[model samples]
Target: MTAVGAPQERAELAPLVTEPERPAPARRSPRRRGRMASWLLYAALAAVTVAFVYPFVWLVSASFKPRSEVFDNKLIPDTFTLDNYVQVWHEAPMALWLLNTVIVTVLATAAVTVSSAMVAWGFSYFRFRGRGPLFGLVLATMMLPGAVTMIPTYLIWNSLGQVGTLTPLWAQNLFGSAFYIFLLRQFFLGLPRELFEAARMDGANQWQVFTRIALPLTRPALVVTALFEFQAAWTDLMRPLIYLRDSSTFTIPRGLKAMLDQFGFGGEWHWEIVVTASVIATVPMIVLFFLGQRHFVEGIATTGSKG
Candidate 1:
Protein backbone atom coordinates (compact mmCIF):
# COMPACT_ATOMS: atom_id res chain seq x y z
CA MET A 1 0.00 0.00 0.00
CA THR A 2 2.86 2.42 0.86
CA ALA A 3 4.76 1.71 -2.37
CA VAL A 4 1.62 2.28 -4.54
CA GLY A 5 0.86 5.53 -2.69
CA ALA A 6 4.50 6.76 -3.24
CA PRO A 7 4.25 6.10 -7.02
CA GLN A 8 0.98 8.07 -7.16
CA GLU A 9 2.58 10.97 -5.25
CA ARG A 10 5.60 11.06 -7.64
CA ALA A 11 3.28 11.19 -10.68
CA GLU A 12 1.29 14.08 -9.16
CA LEU A 13 4.53 16.09 -8.39
CA ALA A 14 5.91 15.84 -11.98
CA PRO A 15 5.48 19.15 -13.88
CA LEU A 16 3.02 19.27 -16.82
CA VAL A 17 4.84 19.32 -20.26
CA THR A 18 4.70 23.02 -21.25
CA GLU A 19 4.94 24.32 -24.86
CA PRO A 20 8.13 26.48 -25.31
CA GLU A 21 7.14 30.11 -25.29
CA ARG A 22 7.08 31.47 -28.85
CA PRO A 23 9.64 34.32 -29.04
CA ALA A 24 7.71 37.51 -28.42
CA PRO A 25 6.48 38.74 -31.83
CA ALA A 26 9.31 40.59 -33.56
CA ARG A 27 9.20 44.35 -32.95
CA ARG A 28 9.47 44.95 -36.69
CA SER A 29 9.43 42.76 -39.82
CA PRO A 30 12.52 42.43 -42.11
CA ARG A 31 10.60 44.23 -44.87
CA ARG A 32 9.83 47.07 -42.46
CA ARG A 33 13.51 47.38 -41.42
CA GLY A 34 14.64 47.46 -45.07
CA ARG A 35 12.08 50.12 -45.92
CA MET A 36 13.21 52.24 -42.97
CA ALA A 37 16.88 52.02 -44.00
CA SER A 38 16.07 52.91 -47.60
CA TRP A 39 14.07 55.94 -46.54
CA LEU A 40 16.94 57.09 -44.30
CA LEU A 41 19.42 56.76 -47.14
CA TYR A 42 17.25 58.80 -49.50
CA ALA A 43 16.80 61.46 -46.87
CA ALA A 44 20.58 61.74 -46.45
CA LEU A 45 21.09 62.09 -50.21
CA ALA A 46 18.41 64.78 -50.47
CA ALA A 47 20.03 66.76 -47.65
CA VAL A 48 23.43 66.59 -49.31
CA THR A 49 21.99 67.75 -52.64
CA VAL A 50 20.34 70.75 -51.06
CA ALA A 51 23.55 71.67 -49.21
CA PHE A 52 25.58 71.73 -52.40
CA VAL A 53 22.91 73.42 -54.52
CA TYR A 54 21.80 76.13 -52.11
CA PRO A 55 24.80 78.39 -52.68
CA PHE A 56 24.20 78.55 -56.44
CA VAL A 57 20.54 79.31 -55.79
CA TRP A 58 21.55 82.13 -53.48
CA LEU A 59 23.95 83.48 -56.08
CA VAL A 60 21.26 83.56 -58.78
CA SER A 61 18.86 85.37 -56.49
CA ALA A 62 21.55 87.79 -55.32
CA SER A 63 22.46 88.63 -58.90
CA PHE A 64 19.03 90.20 -59.30
CA LYS A 65 19.20 92.13 -56.02
CA PRO A 66 20.40 95.69 -55.44
CA ARG A 67 24.02 96.16 -54.47
CA SER A 68 23.10 97.08 -50.90
CA GLU A 69 21.14 93.82 -50.52
CA VAL A 70 23.62 91.35 -51.97
CA PHE A 71 24.82 90.17 -48.55
CA ASP A 72 21.41 90.15 -46.91
CA ASN A 73 21.11 86.32 -46.81
CA LYS A 74 17.64 86.48 -48.29
CA LEU A 75 16.71 84.50 -51.37
CA ILE A 76 14.12 87.05 -52.48
CA PRO A 77 15.26 90.62 -52.58
CA ASP A 78 13.28 93.74 -51.63
CA THR A 79 14.17 95.22 -55.02
CA PHE A 80 14.96 93.41 -58.26
CA THR A 81 16.74 95.27 -61.03
CA LEU A 82 18.01 94.68 -64.55
CA ASP A 83 20.51 97.47 -64.08
CA ASN A 84 23.14 94.87 -63.18
CA TYR A 85 22.68 93.08 -66.51
CA VAL A 86 22.71 96.42 -68.28
CA GLN A 87 25.91 97.33 -66.54
CA VAL A 88 27.47 93.96 -67.34
CA TRP A 89 27.23 94.70 -71.07
CA HIS A 90 28.64 98.23 -70.91
CA GLU A 91 31.03 98.09 -67.95
CA ALA A 92 33.65 96.21 -69.95
CA PRO A 93 34.37 94.64 -73.34
CA MET A 94 32.49 91.49 -72.28
CA ALA A 95 31.49 90.43 -75.78
CA LEU A 96 35.10 90.74 -76.94
CA TRP A 97 36.32 88.87 -73.90
CA LEU A 98 33.79 86.09 -74.55
CA LEU A 99 35.00 85.75 -78.13
CA ASN A 100 38.64 85.51 -77.04
CA THR A 101 37.78 82.90 -74.40
CA VAL A 102 35.84 80.85 -76.93
CA ILE A 103 38.62 80.92 -79.50
CA VAL A 104 41.41 80.02 -77.08
CA THR A 105 39.42 77.39 -75.19
CA VAL A 106 38.12 75.65 -78.31
CA LEU A 107 41.52 75.51 -79.97
CA ALA A 108 43.38 74.37 -76.86
CA THR A 109 40.73 71.74 -76.04
CA ALA A 110 40.91 70.25 -79.56
CA ALA A 111 44.68 70.15 -79.48
CA VAL A 112 44.79 68.48 -76.09
CA THR A 113 42.27 65.81 -77.02
CA VAL A 114 43.89 64.95 -80.36
CA SER A 115 47.46 65.07 -79.12
CA SER A 116 46.79 63.19 -75.90
CA ALA A 117 44.85 60.48 -77.72
CA MET A 118 47.63 60.01 -80.29
CA VAL A 119 50.32 59.83 -77.61
CA ALA A 120 48.22 57.36 -75.65
CA TRP A 121 47.74 55.20 -78.75
CA GLY A 122 51.47 55.06 -79.38
CA PHE A 123 52.23 54.14 -75.79
CA SER A 124 49.55 51.46 -75.69
CA TYR A 125 49.86 49.80 -79.12
CA PHE A 126 53.48 50.43 -80.22
CA ARG A 127 56.42 48.39 -78.94
CA PHE A 128 59.45 50.27 -80.21
CA ARG A 129 62.68 50.63 -78.22
CA GLY A 130 62.75 53.49 -75.67
CA ARG A 131 58.96 53.59 -75.66
CA GLY A 132 58.95 52.71 -71.98
CA PRO A 133 61.58 55.32 -71.15
CA LEU A 134 59.70 57.98 -73.13
CA PHE A 135 56.53 57.18 -71.22
CA GLY A 136 58.45 57.52 -67.96
CA LEU A 137 59.66 60.94 -69.10
CA VAL A 138 56.08 61.91 -69.92
CA LEU A 139 55.02 60.98 -66.38
CA ALA A 140 58.00 62.91 -64.94
CA THR A 141 56.75 66.02 -66.70
CA MET A 142 53.68 66.04 -64.46
CA MET A 143 55.85 66.55 -61.36
CA LEU A 144 57.29 69.84 -62.66
CA PRO A 145 55.18 72.74 -61.49
CA GLY A 146 53.62 74.94 -64.15
CA ALA A 147 54.72 78.04 -62.20
CA VAL A 148 58.36 77.01 -62.47
CA THR A 149 58.06 76.65 -66.25
CA MET A 150 55.95 79.77 -66.75
CA ILE A 151 58.71 82.35 -67.12
CA PRO A 152 60.87 80.13 -69.32
CA THR A 153 57.89 79.26 -71.49
CA TYR A 154 56.84 82.91 -71.75
CA LEU A 155 60.38 83.91 -72.73
CA ILE A 156 60.46 81.17 -75.34
CA TRP A 157 57.15 82.30 -76.77
CA ASN A 158 58.35 85.89 -76.64
CA SER A 159 61.47 84.88 -78.56
CA LEU A 160 59.22 83.32 -81.16
CA GLY A 161 57.22 86.59 -81.33
CA GLN A 162 54.01 84.99 -80.05
CA VAL A 163 53.84 86.20 -76.44
CA GLY A 164 51.27 88.99 -76.75
CA THR A 165 48.70 86.81 -78.54
CA LEU A 166 46.49 83.76 -77.68
CA THR A 167 48.79 81.33 -79.51
CA PRO A 168 51.03 81.02 -76.44
CA LEU A 169 48.03 79.92 -74.43
CA TRP A 170 46.94 77.05 -76.67
CA ALA A 171 50.16 76.09 -78.49
CA GLN A 172 51.60 74.08 -75.59
CA ASN A 173 48.80 71.51 -75.84
CA LEU A 174 50.41 70.17 -79.05
CA PHE A 175 52.90 68.35 -76.82
CA GLY A 176 50.09 66.50 -75.02
CA SER A 177 49.88 65.73 -71.27
CA ALA A 178 51.25 62.89 -69.14
CA PHE A 179 48.03 62.58 -67.12
CA TYR A 180 45.69 62.45 -70.09
CA ILE A 181 47.99 60.12 -72.03
CA PHE A 182 48.21 57.75 -69.09
CA LEU A 183 44.44 57.82 -68.71
CA LEU A 184 43.77 57.03 -72.35
CA ARG A 185 46.57 54.44 -72.51
CA GLN A 186 44.97 52.38 -69.78
CA PHE A 187 41.72 52.41 -71.70
CA PHE A 188 43.51 51.40 -74.89
CA LEU A 189 45.29 48.52 -73.14
CA GLY A 190 41.96 47.16 -71.94
CA LEU A 191 40.75 47.07 -75.56
CA PRO A 192 41.03 43.65 -77.23
CA ARG A 193 44.24 43.31 -79.27
CA GLU A 194 42.27 41.00 -81.55
CA LEU A 195 40.22 43.92 -82.94
CA PHE A 196 43.35 45.82 -83.95
CA GLU A 197 44.95 42.66 -85.36
CA ALA A 198 41.83 41.86 -87.35
CA ALA A 199 41.76 45.41 -88.74
CA ARG A 200 45.43 45.27 -89.70
CA MET A 201 44.91 41.88 -91.35
CA ASP A 202 42.31 43.56 -93.57
CA GLY A 203 44.98 46.03 -94.86
CA ALA A 204 43.83 48.95 -92.65
CA ASN A 205 46.69 51.33 -91.96
CA GLN A 206 47.50 52.70 -88.51
CA TRP A 207 45.70 55.97 -89.24
CA GLN A 208 42.63 54.15 -90.47
CA VAL A 209 42.69 51.81 -87.48
CA PHE A 210 42.91 54.72 -85.04
CA THR A 211 40.24 56.78 -86.74
CA ARG A 212 37.78 54.13 -87.88
CA ILE A 213 38.11 51.60 -85.07
CA ALA A 214 39.80 52.91 -81.91
CA LEU A 215 38.29 56.36 -81.71
CA PRO A 216 34.79 55.26 -82.62
CA LEU A 217 34.87 52.53 -80.01
CA THR A 218 36.43 54.73 -77.33
CA ARG A 219 33.85 57.49 -77.57
CA PRO A 220 33.19 57.57 -73.84
CA ALA A 221 36.83 58.14 -72.88
CA LEU A 222 37.35 60.66 -75.69
CA VAL A 223 34.29 62.64 -74.66
CA VAL A 224 35.47 62.74 -71.07
CA THR A 225 38.91 63.94 -72.10
CA ALA A 226 37.45 66.66 -74.29
CA LEU A 227 35.15 67.85 -71.55
CA PHE A 228 38.01 68.05 -69.04
CA GLU A 229 40.16 69.97 -71.52
CA PHE A 230 37.29 72.33 -72.22
CA GLN A 231 36.77 73.11 -68.54
CA ALA A 232 40.51 73.61 -67.92
CA ALA A 233 40.79 76.01 -70.83
CA TRP A 234 37.63 77.83 -69.87
CA THR A 235 38.59 78.47 -66.26
CA ASP A 236 42.23 79.38 -66.90
CA LEU A 237 43.07 82.85 -65.66
CA MET A 238 46.81 82.82 -65.09
CA ARG A 239 47.70 81.92 -68.68
CA PRO A 240 45.67 84.83 -70.02
CA LEU A 241 47.00 87.16 -67.32
CA ILE A 242 50.58 86.42 -68.33
CA TYR A 243 50.20 86.36 -72.11
CA LEU A 244 47.39 88.82 -72.88
CA ARG A 245 48.69 92.39 -73.03
CA ASP A 246 45.66 94.05 -74.57
CA SER A 247 42.29 94.43 -72.85
CA SER A 248 40.65 93.56 -76.15
CA THR A 249 42.28 90.13 -76.15
CA PHE A 250 41.63 89.31 -72.50
CA THR A 251 39.81 86.05 -71.76
CA ILE A 252 36.66 86.15 -69.62
CA PRO A 253 38.54 85.46 -66.37
CA ARG A 254 41.17 88.13 -67.03
CA GLY A 255 38.50 90.62 -68.00
CA LEU A 256 36.57 89.81 -64.85
CA LYS A 257 39.69 90.36 -62.79
CA ALA A 258 40.25 93.72 -64.47
CA MET A 259 36.66 94.62 -63.76
CA LEU A 260 37.07 93.72 -60.08
CA ASP A 261 40.21 95.82 -59.83
CA GLN A 262 38.52 98.77 -61.50
CA PHE A 263 35.21 98.56 -59.62
CA GLY A 264 35.74 96.67 -56.33
CA PHE A 265 38.92 98.48 -55.31
CA GLY A 266 37.34 101.84 -54.56
CA GLY A 267 34.47 103.77 -52.99
CA GLU A 268 31.81 102.81 -55.51
CA TRP A 269 31.97 99.01 -55.49
CA HIS A 270 29.50 97.68 -58.06
CA TRP A 271 28.85 94.25 -56.52
CA GLU A 272 25.71 93.62 -58.57
CA ILE A 273 27.53 94.05 -61.86
CA VAL A 274 30.34 91.79 -60.66
CA VAL A 275 27.77 89.19 -59.68
CA THR A 276 26.03 89.53 -63.04
CA ALA A 277 29.27 88.97 -64.90
CA SER A 278 29.93 85.85 -62.83
CA VAL A 279 26.52 84.48 -63.80
CA ILE A 280 27.24 85.08 -67.48
CA ALA A 281 30.61 83.36 -67.24
CA THR A 282 29.21 80.40 -65.27
CA VAL A 283 26.14 79.62 -67.41
CA PRO A 284 28.04 77.89 -70.20
CA MET A 285 29.75 75.47 -67.81
CA ILE A 286 26.42 74.63 -66.21
CA VAL A 287 24.84 74.02 -69.59
CA LEU A 288 27.74 71.85 -70.71
CA PHE A 289 27.51 69.71 -67.59
CA PHE A 290 23.79 69.17 -68.07
CA LEU A 291 24.27 68.20 -71.70
CA GLY A 292 27.11 65.72 -71.16
CA GLN A 293 26.35 64.45 -67.65
CA ARG A 294 25.77 60.95 -68.98
CA HIS A 295 29.10 60.75 -70.75
CA PHE A 296 30.91 62.50 -67.90
CA VAL A 297 29.58 59.95 -65.40
CA GLU A 298 30.51 57.01 -67.61
CA GLY A 299 34.07 58.23 -68.20
CA ILE A 300 34.73 58.56 -64.50
CA ALA A 301 33.12 55.24 -63.69
CA THR A 302 34.94 53.07 -66.24
CA THR A 303 38.13 55.03 -66.86
CA GLY A 304 40.55 52.33 -65.70
CA SER A 305 38.25 49.30 -65.83
CA LYS A 306 38.63 46.40 -68.23
CA GLY A 307 35.96 45.96 -70.91
Candidate 2:
Protein backbone atom coordinates (compact mmCIF):
# COMPACT_ATOMS: atom_id res chain seq x y z
CA MET A 1 0.00 0.00 0.00
CA THR A 2 1.81 3.18 -1.18
CA ALA A 3 1.00 6.69 -0.02
CA VAL A 4 -1.03 8.88 -2.46
CA GLY A 5 0.80 11.63 -4.47
CA ALA A 6 0.49 15.27 -3.34
CA PRO A 7 -1.81 16.24 -6.29
CA GLN A 8 -4.12 13.27 -5.61
CA GLU A 9 -4.27 14.11 -1.90
CA ARG A 10 -5.09 17.80 -2.65
CA ALA A 11 -7.78 16.81 -5.17
CA GLU A 12 -9.44 14.48 -2.63
CA LEU A 13 -9.38 17.21 0.11
CA ALA A 14 -10.83 19.82 -2.35
CA PRO A 15 -13.84 17.58 -3.01
CA LEU A 16 -14.30 17.17 0.75
CA VAL A 17 -14.11 20.96 1.26
CA THR A 18 -16.68 21.39 -1.57
CA GLU A 19 -15.60 25.05 -2.25
CA PRO A 20 -17.53 26.26 0.87
CA GLU A 21 -20.78 26.33 -1.13
CA ARG A 22 -19.75 29.57 -2.98
CA PRO A 23 -20.24 31.78 0.15
CA ALA A 24 -23.89 32.56 -0.71
CA PRO A 25 -22.97 35.83 -2.60
CA ALA A 26 -22.42 37.94 0.55
CA ARG A 27 -25.78 39.76 1.01
CA ARG A 28 -25.78 43.39 2.16
CA SER A 29 -26.02 43.78 5.95
CA PRO A 30 -29.58 44.16 7.27
CA ARG A 31 -28.43 46.98 9.61
CA ARG A 32 -27.06 49.02 6.69
CA ARG A 33 -30.30 48.59 4.75
CA GLY A 34 -32.31 49.58 7.80
CA ARG A 35 -30.23 52.72 8.23
CA MET A 36 -30.78 53.74 4.61
CA ALA A 37 -34.53 53.08 4.93
CA SER A 38 -34.71 55.18 8.09
CA TRP A 39 -32.89 58.08 6.42
CA LEU A 40 -35.32 58.03 3.51
CA LEU A 41 -38.24 57.94 5.89
CA TYR A 42 -36.85 60.92 7.78
CA ALA A 43 -36.35 62.85 4.55
CA ALA A 44 -39.95 62.18 3.48
CA LEU A 45 -41.27 63.19 6.87
CA ALA A 46 -39.20 66.38 6.82
CA ALA A 47 -40.60 67.33 3.41
CA VAL A 48 -44.15 66.72 4.60
CA THR A 49 -43.56 68.78 7.73
CA VAL A 50 -42.19 71.67 5.70
CA ALA A 51 -45.18 71.58 3.38
CA PHE A 52 -47.64 71.73 6.26
CA VAL A 53 -45.72 74.37 8.19
CA TYR A 54 -44.79 76.73 5.36
CA PRO A 55 -48.17 78.41 5.11
CA PHE A 56 -48.15 79.20 8.79
CA VAL A 57 -44.59 80.45 8.54
CA TRP A 58 -45.61 82.67 5.63
CA LEU A 59 -48.63 83.89 7.55
CA VAL A 60 -46.48 85.04 10.47
CA SER A 61 -44.06 86.69 8.07
CA ALA A 62 -46.88 88.46 6.21
CA SER A 63 -48.30 89.72 9.48
CA PHE A 64 -45.09 91.66 9.90
CA LYS A 65 -44.94 92.81 6.28
CA PRO A 66 -46.34 96.04 4.93
CA ARG A 67 -49.71 96.03 3.18
CA SER A 68 -48.09 96.28 -0.24
CA GLU A 69 -45.78 93.34 0.38
CA VAL A 70 -48.32 90.80 1.66
CA PHE A 71 -49.25 88.07 -0.85
CA ASP A 72 -45.79 88.48 -2.38
CA ASN A 73 -45.20 84.84 -1.45
CA LYS A 74 -42.01 85.73 0.28
CA LEU A 75 -41.04 83.90 3.43
CA ILE A 76 -39.55 87.09 4.86
CA PRO A 77 -40.43 90.69 4.29
CA ASP A 78 -37.81 93.19 3.16
CA THR A 79 -39.43 95.83 5.31
CA PHE A 80 -40.69 94.66 8.68
CA THR A 81 -43.29 96.54 10.64
CA LEU A 82 -45.04 95.86 13.92
CA ASP A 83 -47.51 98.53 12.85
CA ASN A 84 -49.92 95.95 11.52
CA TYR A 85 -50.25 94.38 14.94
CA VAL A 86 -50.38 97.69 16.74
CA GLN A 87 -52.92 99.17 14.34
CA VAL A 88 -55.06 96.00 14.45
CA TRP A 89 -55.91 96.60 18.09
CA HIS A 90 -57.11 100.08 17.24
CA GLU A 91 -58.87 99.42 13.93
CA ALA A 92 -61.00 96.71 15.50
CA PRO A 93 -62.26 95.91 18.97
CA MET A 94 -59.58 93.21 19.17
CA ALA A 95 -59.28 93.17 22.93
CA LEU A 96 -63.03 92.83 23.38
CA TRP A 97 -63.26 90.21 20.67
CA LEU A 98 -60.42 88.17 22.21
CA LEU A 99 -62.02 88.36 25.65
CA ASN A 100 -65.37 87.30 24.22
CA THR A 101 -63.81 84.38 22.39
CA VAL A 102 -61.95 83.22 25.48
CA ILE A 103 -65.13 83.34 27.56
CA VAL A 104 -67.16 81.40 24.99
CA THR A 105 -64.42 78.83 24.37
CA VAL A 106 -64.05 78.18 28.10
CA LEU A 107 -67.79 77.83 28.62
CA ALA A 108 -68.31 75.63 25.59
CA THR A 109 -65.31 73.40 26.38
CA ALA A 110 -66.30 72.88 30.01
CA ALA A 111 -69.94 72.25 29.22
CA VAL A 112 -69.26 69.71 26.49
CA THR A 113 -66.60 67.87 28.49
CA VAL A 114 -68.75 67.46 31.61
CA SER A 115 -71.94 66.69 29.73
CA SER A 116 -70.31 64.31 27.26
CA ALA A 117 -68.50 62.46 30.04
CA MET A 118 -71.73 62.01 31.97
CA VAL A 119 -73.59 60.63 28.98
CA ALA A 120 -70.65 58.43 28.04
CA TRP A 121 -70.30 57.03 31.55
CA GLY A 122 -74.01 56.29 31.65
CA PHE A 123 -73.84 54.44 28.38
CA SER A 124 -70.81 52.47 29.49
CA TYR A 125 -72.03 51.53 32.99
CA PHE A 126 -75.79 51.22 32.79
CA ARG A 127 -77.46 48.01 31.71
CA PHE A 128 -81.02 48.46 30.63
CA ARG A 129 -83.64 47.64 28.06
CA GLY A 130 -83.20 49.70 24.85
CA ARG A 131 -79.72 50.80 25.95
CA GLY A 132 -78.27 49.64 22.68
CA PRO A 133 -80.98 51.26 20.65
CA LEU A 134 -80.62 54.50 22.61
CA PHE A 135 -76.90 54.57 22.11
CA GLY A 136 -77.39 53.88 18.43
CA LEU A 137 -79.89 56.69 18.16
CA VAL A 138 -77.45 59.08 19.87
CA LEU A 139 -74.69 58.08 17.51
CA ALA A 140 -77.02 58.45 14.52
CA THR A 141 -77.30 62.14 15.29
CA MET A 142 -73.74 62.57 14.04
CA MET A 143 -74.71 61.43 10.58
CA LEU A 144 -77.02 64.41 10.18
CA PRO A 145 -75.26 67.50 8.89
CA GLY A 146 -75.24 70.62 11.04
CA ALA A 147 -77.25 72.46 8.36
CA VAL A 148 -80.21 70.17 8.90
CA THR A 149 -80.55 71.22 12.54
CA MET A 150 -79.24 74.79 12.33
CA ILE A 151 -82.58 76.38 11.45
CA PRO A 152 -84.50 74.57 14.17
CA THR A 153 -81.72 75.29 16.65
CA TYR A 154 -81.83 78.95 15.72
CA LEU A 155 -85.60 79.03 16.10
CA ILE A 156 -85.32 77.42 19.52
CA TRP A 157 -82.79 79.98 20.65
CA ASN A 158 -84.85 82.74 19.05
CA SER A 159 -87.94 81.55 20.89
CA LEU A 160 -85.97 81.73 24.11
CA GLY A 161 -84.90 85.26 23.03
CA GLN A 162 -81.27 84.19 23.30
CA VAL A 163 -80.43 85.22 19.75
CA GLY A 164 -77.75 87.87 19.29
CA THR A 165 -76.18 86.76 22.56
CA LEU A 166 -73.20 84.65 23.68
CA THR A 167 -75.65 82.23 25.33
CA PRO A 168 -76.53 80.71 21.99
CA LEU A 169 -72.86 80.10 21.20
CA TRP A 170 -72.12 77.87 24.18
CA ALA A 171 -75.59 76.82 25.38
CA GLN A 172 -76.05 74.16 22.74
CA ASN A 173 -73.10 72.21 24.20
CA LEU A 174 -75.03 71.53 27.42
CA PHE A 175 -76.84 68.68 25.61
CA GLY A 176 -73.57 66.78 25.04
CA SER A 177 -72.21 66.53 21.51
CA ALA A 178 -72.76 63.20 19.79
CA PHE A 179 -69.14 62.95 18.67
CA TYR A 180 -67.59 63.76 22.04
CA ILE A 181 -69.99 61.39 23.73
CA PHE A 182 -68.88 58.64 21.38
CA LEU A 183 -65.21 59.35 21.93
CA LEU A 184 -65.55 59.44 25.70
CA ARG A 185 -67.75 56.37 25.72
CA GLN A 186 -65.02 54.42 23.99
CA PHE A 187 -62.60 55.46 26.70
CA PHE A 188 -65.07 54.60 29.45
CA LEU A 189 -65.77 51.19 27.99
CA GLY A 190 -62.06 50.42 28.16
CA LEU A 191 -62.04 50.88 31.95
CA PRO A 192 -62.03 47.97 34.37
CA ARG A 193 -65.50 47.05 35.55
CA GLU A 194 -64.05 45.71 38.76
CA LEU A 195 -63.09 49.19 39.81
CA PHE A 196 -66.64 50.41 39.66
CA GLU A 197 -67.82 47.27 41.44
CA ALA A 198 -65.28 47.78 44.20
CA ALA A 199 -66.29 51.42 44.54
CA ARG A 200 -69.89 50.34 44.91
CA MET A 201 -68.94 47.76 47.54
CA ASP A 202 -67.08 50.51 49.37
CA GLY A 203 -70.34 52.50 49.50
CA ALA A 204 -69.33 55.05 46.90
CA ASN A 205 -72.31 56.23 44.92
CA GLN A 206 -72.52 56.33 41.15
CA TRP A 207 -71.48 59.96 41.03
CA GLN A 208 -68.50 59.31 43.27
CA VAL A 209 -67.46 56.37 41.16
CA PHE A 210 -67.61 58.57 38.12
CA THR A 211 -65.99 61.71 39.50
CA ARG A 212 -63.45 60.01 41.72
CA ILE A 213 -62.50 56.97 39.69
CA ALA A 214 -63.59 57.27 36.09
CA LEU A 215 -62.60 60.85 35.49
CA PRO A 216 -59.22 60.37 37.10
CA LEU A 217 -58.55 57.24 35.10
CA THR A 218 -59.54 58.89 31.85
CA ARG A 219 -57.74 62.19 32.30
CA PRO A 220 -55.95 61.88 28.97
CA ALA A 221 -59.19 61.33 27.12
CA LEU A 222 -60.79 64.24 28.95
CA VAL A 223 -57.86 66.45 28.05
CA VAL A 224 -58.20 65.42 24.44
CA THR A 225 -61.90 66.19 24.59
CA ALA A 226 -61.40 69.61 26.14
CA LEU A 227 -58.64 70.51 23.69
CA PHE A 228 -60.84 69.52 20.76
CA GLU A 229 -63.77 71.56 22.01
CA PHE A 230 -61.53 74.47 22.79
CA GLN A 231 -60.20 74.56 19.23
CA ALA A 232 -63.67 74.08 17.75
CA ALA A 233 -65.28 76.82 19.80
CA TRP A 234 -62.38 79.15 19.27
CA THR A 235 -62.49 78.66 15.53
CA ASP A 236 -66.28 78.53 15.17
CA LEU A 237 -67.36 81.23 12.76
CA MET A 238 -70.73 80.11 11.43
CA ARG A 239 -72.57 80.04 14.74
CA PRO A 240 -71.17 83.40 15.74
CA LEU A 241 -72.08 84.87 12.37
CA ILE A 242 -75.67 83.65 12.75
CA TYR A 243 -76.17 84.65 16.38
CA LEU A 244 -73.95 87.65 17.07
CA ARG A 245 -75.30 90.86 15.58
CA ASP A 246 -73.36 93.43 17.57
CA SER A 247 -69.67 94.14 17.03
CA SER A 248 -69.09 94.08 20.78
CA THR A 249 -70.53 90.56 20.98
CA PHE A 250 -68.25 89.19 18.29
CA THR A 251 -65.81 86.35 19.00
CA ILE A 252 -62.40 86.31 17.35
CA PRO A 253 -63.63 84.50 14.23
CA ARG A 254 -66.53 86.87 13.88
CA GLY A 255 -64.25 89.79 14.48
CA LEU A 256 -61.85 88.46 11.87
CA LYS A 257 -64.76 88.18 9.48
CA ALA A 258 -65.64 91.75 10.28
CA MET A 259 -62.03 92.70 9.62
CA LEU A 260 -62.15 90.90 6.27
CA ASP A 261 -65.27 92.76 5.37
CA GLN A 262 -63.87 96.06 6.54
CA PHE A 263 -60.31 95.70 5.38
CA GLY A 264 -59.69 92.74 3.13
CA PHE A 265 -62.36 93.33 0.50
CA GLY A 266 -63.76 96.85 0.23
CA GLY A 267 -63.21 98.81 3.37
CA GLU A 268 -59.69 100.01 4.09
CA TRP A 269 -57.75 97.66 1.80
CA HIS A 270 -55.24 97.16 4.60
CA TRP A 271 -54.69 93.46 4.03
CA GLU A 272 -51.79 93.33 6.47
CA ILE A 273 -54.12 94.08 9.36
CA VAL A 274 -56.32 91.14 8.44
CA VAL A 275 -53.23 88.96 8.19
CA THR A 276 -52.15 90.13 11.60
CA ALA A 277 -55.54 89.31 13.04
CA SER A 278 -55.44 85.85 11.52
CA VAL A 279 -52.02 85.18 13.02
CA ILE A 280 -53.33 86.25 16.40
CA ALA A 281 -56.37 84.03 16.05
CA THR A 282 -54.25 81.06 14.97
CA VAL A 283 -51.53 81.36 17.61
CA PRO A 284 -53.67 80.22 20.55
CA MET A 285 -54.62 76.93 18.90
CA ILE A 286 -50.99 76.31 17.91
CA VAL A 287 -49.89 77.00 21.47
CA LEU A 288 -52.56 74.69 22.84
CA PHE A 289 -51.58 71.81 20.54
CA PHE A 290 -47.93 72.15 21.47
CA LEU A 291 -48.81 72.14 25.15
CA GLY A 292 -51.14 69.11 24.98
CA GLN A 293 -49.51 67.23 22.10
CA ARG A 294 -48.32 64.37 24.33
CA HIS A 295 -51.68 63.65 25.93
CA PHE A 296 -53.41 64.30 22.64
CA VAL A 297 -51.34 61.69 20.85
CA GLU A 298 -51.58 59.23 23.74
CA GLY A 299 -55.33 59.64 24.11
CA ILE A 300 -55.97 59.21 20.41
CA ALA A 301 -53.67 56.19 20.21
CA THR A 302 -55.21 54.43 23.22
CA THR A 303 -58.88 55.43 22.93
CA GLY A 304 -60.39 52.16 21.74
CA SER A 305 -57.53 49.87 22.76
CA LYS A 306 -59.56 47.75 25.15
CA GLY A 307 -63.00 48.51 23.81
Highest lDDT model number? 2
Best by TM-score: 2
Global CA lDDT computed for model 1: 0.84
Error of 1 at 153 (Å): 0.7
Q: Residue 49 in candidate 1 has what lDDT?
A: 100
**RMSD, model 2, all Cα superposed?**
11.7
Question: How far in Å is the alpha carbon of 88 misplaced in model 1?
Answer: 0.6
Residues 205-227, model 1: lDDT tens digits: 99999989998887777888888
TM-scores for every predicted model: 0.84, 0.85
Off by over 4 Å in 1: 1-40, 301-307
The worst-scoring run of ten residues by lDDT in candidate 2 lies at 20-29
| lDDT, candidate 1, at 194 | 96
Residue-level lDDT tens digits of model 2 in 104-173:
9999999999999999999999998999999999989988999998999999999999998999999889
